[model samples]
Target: MVDVTELEQRCADAWPALVDEPLGGWRLRAAGGFTGRANSALTLGDPGLPVPQALDRVKLFAAAHGIAPCAHVVVGAPVEAAVADARWRVDVDHPGGAESLVMTGTLRGFATPKDRAAAVAGTPSPGWWELAAQANPTTAQRRVLGSGSRVGFGEVEREGVVVGAVRGAVVGEVLHVARLAVRPEARRGGVARSLMGALATWGLEHGARVCALQVAEHNSPAVTLYRALGCAEHHRYRYWVPGA
Candidate 1:
């Protein structure tokens, strides 16, 4: 088993490299946080251990940490055995998948202004910024914006007045999809997709070739939409809340 302290340091050190892979962002960062014992005896990235062993290593590490595995993914291995432990929620798909379904797909083009306006008018939910602001009106939104990690690209309107927006980031060769917001009355008219396309286009122009984001696996409708948009699975993760 790895040392808990070392695990913390390793996770931090390894984070920037990991998140650089498109779908990495604030929500993904939050999902990546560590809060237990350390048994990160395995390595990730190039030349890393094979998938089966890696899963075993992660599971062991989770047990050592006293938390169930948060996100467990397996390829080239059986799914049932990997998910046998009670702590994690697991997902399995084809090995080295290309034809497999996407968990977070890359959007490949830019959105037109007309498309952006229409999307803002039709988006269905509040973004992380709005939700954060609602949770604590004074600090979160400002803190995130202040980090210079976020960029806004569209306008949102409510009651015939602009009130919602979309945000994203361009990091190296990948563009991270950050937030999409729309007033409650406007929920299903391709707003989110338009916002995603805008970011993807921005990334390509800025020297990026990939755009990535994540969503709940159970959000079937969203998974369908992303797949239809040409996104393929990059990777997936899960959250292991401490208790009920």
Candidate 2:
């Protein structure tokens, strides 16, 4: 079984929560209403203040940014209980607001098919950002996807146009994957699989033995894809918002 505590810390390090302020130990993040992972406060360790005070600070910060106050709490963390006791309900309305699984796997077994022509780049290309995001990416979104010590942007091109795009970040022995997307016309053509294979190869080259990614519980297709690629659930986390 993957160690939940260690996995949590690894994830925080690999895909850092870009925050506006460090409230004691918590990360106060706001990313222009992007994914919940970037927009919510990540309550990892103790906040060095009373739970109420910490919560108050989070609320004020979010309010000032014209966004809802949300906290990303690991399932078994102490802050999860505290937030629940304070009547902060788990967010379920937003697309990625509910529980998400952290999946991890070894990269050695990933084999890129000879027929697929996937390439790994040091930075995301303009076509990659367009296809993966389906629109112009916000500055915060770009940072969330691209900012890391060792980041790889993988893409599969078809007829000279980028069709599939994915990102991988190597931190310690873990390679964190995110932003996997296939163009509408390129779906179901093994593009996603090719992209993953390329990323796994890149990860292995960068001294990463383990690969990890976060997927929403309701995304059955993506979950199935990752599972087929040897990923298993390491832990779960949810976004908690103040009040119902």
Candidate with maximal lDDT: 2
Q: After superposition, how far is residue 38 of candidate 1 from its true place, in Å?
A: 17
Give the top-scoring candidate (TM-score).
2
120-159: candidate 1 lDDT, tens digit per residue: 2222234434532343333324433323332434444446
TM-score of each: 0.50, 0.91
Alpha-carbon lDDT, every model: 0.40, 0.83
lDDT of 2 by residue, 30-149 (tens): 877767877788887788898778988899989887678988888987788888888888888868749999999989777564456788999888889887674687777777776888
What are the clash counts of all predictions, listed in order?
A: 6, 0
* Regions more than 4 Å wrong, model 1: 1-107, 113-115, 118-128, 131-146, 158-164, 240-244
Task: Give the per-residue Cα lDDT of candidate 1 at 15.
Answer: 25
Relative to the unseen true structure, what is the C-alpha lDDT of residue 4 in candidate 2, on a scale of 0 to 100? 68
The RMSD of every model to the true structure, in order and in angstroms, is: 10.0, 2.1
When summed lDDT is taken over every stretch of 10 residues in candidate 2, the lowest stretch is: 11-20
